[model samples]
Target: MVLGGDFNTSRPELLAPIAQIARECDGRSYAPGDASQEVTHYTYVTAPGPAYGTYTSSKLDYLYSTDDFTGCDSWTQKADQADYRATTVPTGVSDHAPLYGYTCGGPRLSWDMHGSVDGVVADCSAYDNNGSTLGAVEWSAADGGAAVFGGTGHLATPTPPVDSRLSLSVTAWVKIAANAPTGAIAALDGSRISGFILWYEADGATWRFGMPVADADGWNVDRVIPTVPAVAGKWTHLVATYDAVSGQMALYADGALLGTAQHTSVWKAAGAFTVGRDLVNGRPNAFFHGSIRDVRLYDYPLAPAQAADPTL
Candidate 1:
């Protein structure tokens, strides 16, 4: 299998999952061979500031694979500018360079199947989507499921591509097989307009929504949304929202409002977005080990009724 994109962090903690998957599939790895060869560093950097310069450059993109197949021989990073100096692109485009590669999988196959979406039958199945491997995450829909990560894992400072502005509502249907660790943040971080993040502390089962504060060393906290009394095996819907203007944050569970907080400003828009961990201290830590599905992000805050509707 061939995979490429901004893997975002080089920390061992966040790379563990990708490591495990590589071990299982016998995949070797290669990063930009040198700084001069680095195609794109720092996926998230907002314009118009000096500290902005502090958060400069690193080879955040990568490509990896299991035992090299016959047709899949090499990969390359395609830079938009030949000299590697950053420049503008078309609308709705990210500054990060794109990754191109060749893979040796057999001739493609096709078929049709139906499944329930809002209780209505739809045509789709596992084979519809191809798969790839990231640092530690091996994703494949054809392996009898949509996407599977190798064991519970962590990530550090994983940011989205530069020029990618994500304004959306996120809904996750999660089944927690193992209790998460304290300070587990499942939201966006490390960006100028930091995205939303949801975290829970195992010690108290107290949940909080973390958003950016206008000045440094400040974080606005919403009221804590307590988790349901722990049950060994159970599924839950954990939702959060951020109104760009109000800098207001809210949390909900199974349709009930849990807590809210107010900030002077919303998250800065340029930086890497991360899932299952935080991008702090120049790396990712506080990983979450659980089953997460139907992870959706919306540009606007979702209404209580809309968030609660079971059919969604």
Candidate 2:
């Protein structure tokens, strides 16, 4: 669930209700970085507009959610950093800069290493989200980071049987090791066919997001995002979505739109979903040799605005 608006979050009387609902629902605020009671809003400057005469800074807007579906841990306040804007002066967008968040964990699958023990990939979703270890994997690391394909590492689960007629969106945060250039982060494949895949290209610098429906001559649609200097050894968030109605596919990095294309074929792979690897030629190859975290899948295209936010 999500709740937001100009709640005058700075006021103790108003913050009371916000805190009450969030605590009761395990929710968190999107702005101000954390669940702390402190509020940060209202831009103050000696200019003309809303804050020209007030000469006070106050936080009047807020957003809260019960689900960690957006994959965003903290909100970056533009007002906090003086150098946030290099040369261009702040435009009068409003008294507030845009509050950003990413579109994450839909009604489908969601997983992370948050609550894992020794070497388990705990499914935090409310329904059939547990994954069976395929080959071997290691989880002895920091929070939300797990190593895959040491020798052979992967995770698999029975297909959730979501209706193919619906749209699709998949997102994952991964860090690829130098040794392992090309690897797959996730794929949905059947006995001999595949539905969709989120993997790194052979170049190891670009990520390939593809959906190959059974009826398509080739991949119904594919998007390659160039991420070289910014990808290696760094945790990069990748998001790909397909709009069934519009037949459009879009790919994003971090929270920025990279590119988009069109796809018209329907999905038909009623098989298993695999993470940390992809099935090639009926075999699990393209094994990911890095840390994977915050895997999410949605059954619908994310709103364009939400996709732009790093913490939705």
Candidate 3:
């Protein structure tokens, strides 16, 4: 979606050039219409100590949406990443307020793994969200060709194309090599905080759809785990979904509904949706030790019935 803002005016209508830019780009933003007010803003925080002080400001934030954005969800303020924006908004509370737009419609990012040893994976979607392999990650002939990660490698996408705070679904054909303890199957998270993660727990041998309900940290994660065991060396269709309006998440393994869980608040972990690994608090945590194929990412939550068969 097109994001435009941080201009020298209060009225969006008055901003002719910005509006034109949005029109030309064919995207939307998280701009509000209350008029003459910009409540959620990005900030530049200062050192927090005896001489700590946060009393400066810069331009306003740009959080608008595209014309085609279906049911544009709310634009949330960005939070401080490792206290980077420096911290604290003008209100003197909270860390950061990022503007996120949920472009709910159809598939936004897709990867059809078709080759072995591919360095640059193509994004089959209309948007150019191509991913690249990092470290020891490689495209293997397993599962009709897929990316295999060996603990210390992963596939990284550019700036996230879909918003993490909105209704969304992620699906893939996964093959577990062996159970270690835990590893991120796939996820969307911040630089040091996670937003949502589709992971596995060897202790329970279950596939879980997790979200940090209480906070953006890793420990506060709430999950909806499937009873099905992630049989090692076998391919299983895995699906994880989140309903933004309801604050709920669901998981499915091989077309069967695992279960559901509730997360009443918008747990913010705005960052690139990744493959083969999920990160939090600047920790490696765990990388997916398996092969992931036919990864499809949709902007809206998929119903239980539809989860059985996702269109590539």
lDDT of 3 at 155: 75
Model 1 Cα lDDT, one tens digit per residue, 1-312: 545667776443565666555421112222112112344543334565654423354445655555332111112243322222244452223446554333323212111111123322221222222111223433334413222233444332223321112223455554444555554435555533244456655676655666554313334433345555433235566677655444456777778777777644433535434445544443454555554444444444666786796433
Candidate 1: stretches off by over 4 Å: 1-133, 138-167, 183-185, 191-194, 214-232, 310-312
Ranked candidates, highest TM-score first: 3, 2, 1
Among all windows of 10 consecutive residues in model 1, the one with the lowest summed lDDT is 106-115
Better of 1 and 3 by TM-score: 3
**lDDT score, candidate 2, position 70:** 35
C-alpha-based local distance difference test score of model 3: 0.67
Q: What lDDT would candidate 2 get against the real structure?
A: 0.61
Q: Rank the candidates by lDDT, best first.
A: 3, 2, 1
The top-ranked prediction according to lDDT is 3
